[model samples]
Target: MAEISQVSLGDAIYDRVCQDLVEGKLRPNEKVTIRGLAERLGTSSTPVRDAVQRLLRDEALIQRSMRDVRVPVLTEAQYLEIASIRRELEGFAAGRAAEMVGPKEVRRLKKIVERNEAAAVAGRWPQAVKYNQEFHFALVEAAEMPILLAILSGLWLRMGPLIAGYYAREQLGLVRHHQAIIAACENRDPAAAAAEMRADIDDAKEGIIRYIQSFTIDE
Candidate 1:
């Protein structure tokens, strides 16, 4: 019983840590320690260590040394590759979600969108990023495509930190793609949803690739 409980705790910790990564709560290249995680989570070091190992395997956290780990910082080339993949996969998810969306799902997503818009308007970049992530994940989950969701989660694990770091304040005043997606879903229009989702990804990608090239890419 005790062994089972320990394993459950480790799994829980792993999921919690993954959520932080996927939601951009942990910034790019931020160092983290098992001891710090254990203390923050109010648990012992053992489970935190176990969870850290799994995250290391996932490449979400780079192993700096035997005692040091930090969130991985993606290169420009890597970011572009992932952005292309996200456009295809996430667009499909939105299309399927449109086919399945009901009043309840629409309400939930609208609430997340509202929070994201509010945060962006308030210049709370980190909070806005998290809510943006929440809205995307919720839309995907509504698609009922577990395999696609898993793949997207893995991609987001690597990409989230970069996004969190790169959300420009200037872009907040631009037209939001989420509102178009919601309109498509409310009408159960798969084609429109797919187009809107792809547009959203492309919109972010154009700015993000520029940001990466200007700041991080080598000539």
Candidate 2:
């Protein structure tokens, strides 16, 4: 029982840290220390260390020296590589979701889109980013492909910091490709839904790639 409790605590720590990464609260290349994290989380160091080890094994956090760990700063090439995979997998998920979507799911997704648009209009970048993540994950979840969703979650963990930076710099367009996706889903057109999903990812990739290139050139 105690062993199970400890494992649960470690998992809790891991999840909290991952949520920070997903929400862009953790920046790229930011240093992380087990003691510091434990302090911040108001817990003991054991669970924090366990969680950090898990992240290190997942390549979400890289160990530097004996006590140093940091988030990876992905290069432009790396980012594009991941984005390419996302285009394929995420598009497939959207296609599957099109077949599975019901009126309730459609309305749920529409609400998410509306919330995202409202956040963007209010110039609330963080809220926009949160809603955007919610929207994508919701679509993938509707597909009911657990393995695919797990893969996409890992991809998002790596991309979240970069995405936050991107939305911070650019204005959120009101008529995003999400509308097209919603329409396709409403019409029960799988191919069109997939195409729109791919297009949406490609559009974001282009902008993010440009941003990465400029940063690299500056460096």
Candidate 3:
């Protein structure tokens, strides 16, 4: 019974840390310690250690020493590689979502964009970043493509920290492409939806490259 409980606790801890990565709660290159995370989460070190191990394996976290673990910062090449892949996969998901999206889903997406815009304007960058992720994930989920969503989630786990760094450094104007995507979904135009999704992903390229360069300079 104790062993089973520990296993469950480990899984729970793993998912909580994953949310931190996926939601950009952690920043790129920020150092992490099991003791700190355990305290922050009000848990023991055992489960936190287990969860951090999984993130390390996922390449979401990099270990610099026996005790030093930090979020991995992507290079310009790495970021672009992932972004290119995202354009294809997420664009396909958006196209499929356009095919299946109903009025309710369209409204939900619009609401998400609205919230994201508001957060951006208010300079609540973390909130904006979270809503941005929510909007993309919502679009993919609407497609009802479980396998695609799983693949995208892995990509996002790597991107979230890097993206958060960008957002913290700049203002957001990416919503125009998102709005275009919403319009394409409203029109039930799969090609337009896919194109707009690709555009949105493309828009990130410049900002992410700039951010990556800054990281390189800092390091």
Candidate 4:
């Protein structure tokens, strides 16, 4: 077996926990016990606690008590609100990236988008989730705007559970959305890029809202 490389314990624990949450292994509204989580991750309670605290702050996990946490359920309204903000922010980032993107960054973004599309087609939900995130973050990083990146980072965390739901349900054509956005980037058209970004996010928001509404009506 290959040895696991050592890294920052808190970050390591957080990434693992977040992956589980996004991949539906750690389900929404399910309780998370720090000691149990730590044991499962093959780490100590300290790092797990830190990771839980961060997740709580991110609203990915809600603090139910002093030592207890649960994955927060996504509401329809909250999903729409988060998606709206994310679209605006991501559109701004995309426009900025279009204006400032160099050949190297454009190539990088293309690769990320291509990988995301492949994952979506292959039904590799986790890889799709990872690559979609990488594509957006790569665009923001290309702009060299730390403040914008920070804002988008907060929004992404809030959207994580909802995005996980989208992947699991598999309702929309994510690959097509990504392909359009990549085409805009390739053309170096800021307005076109922003428009594509907004469309992609809006489509996702609609799909999630419709899904949630069906459940609500059923209830």
For lDDT, the strongest prediction is 3
**How does each model score on lDDT?**
0.85, 0.85, 0.90, 0.74
Write the number of the candidate with greater lDDT, choosing between 3 and 4: 3
Candidate 1 C-alpha lDDT tens digits along 1-219: 999999999999999999898888887767899899999999999999999999999889988778769887777788889989999999999999999989999999998888888888888878888888888889999999889888999999998877877774334532278888999999989999999888888777766776555554112
Candidate 2 per-residue lDDT over residues 54-82, each given as its tens digit: 99898888887897788877898889899
lDDT of 4 by residue, 60-173 (tens): 888767865777667877877778888888898888777887789878877887787777778877677777777777888987889988787666666665676666676345
Per-candidate TM-scores read 0.89, 0.90, 0.96, 0.81
**Which candidate, 1 or 4, would have the higher TM-score against the true structure?**
1
**Which of candidates 2 and 3 is the stronger one according to TM-score?**
3
lDDT of 3 by residue, 105-175 (tens): 99999999999999888889899989989999999999999999899999999998888778778876648
What are the per-model C-alpha RMSD values against the true structure? 2.8, 2.4, 1.4, 4.9
Off by over 4 Å in 3: 216-219
- Give the count of colliding residue pairs in each prediction: 0, 0, 0, 0
Ranking by TM-score: 3, 2, 1, 4
Scored against the true structure, residue 184 in model 4 reaches a CA lDDT of 74
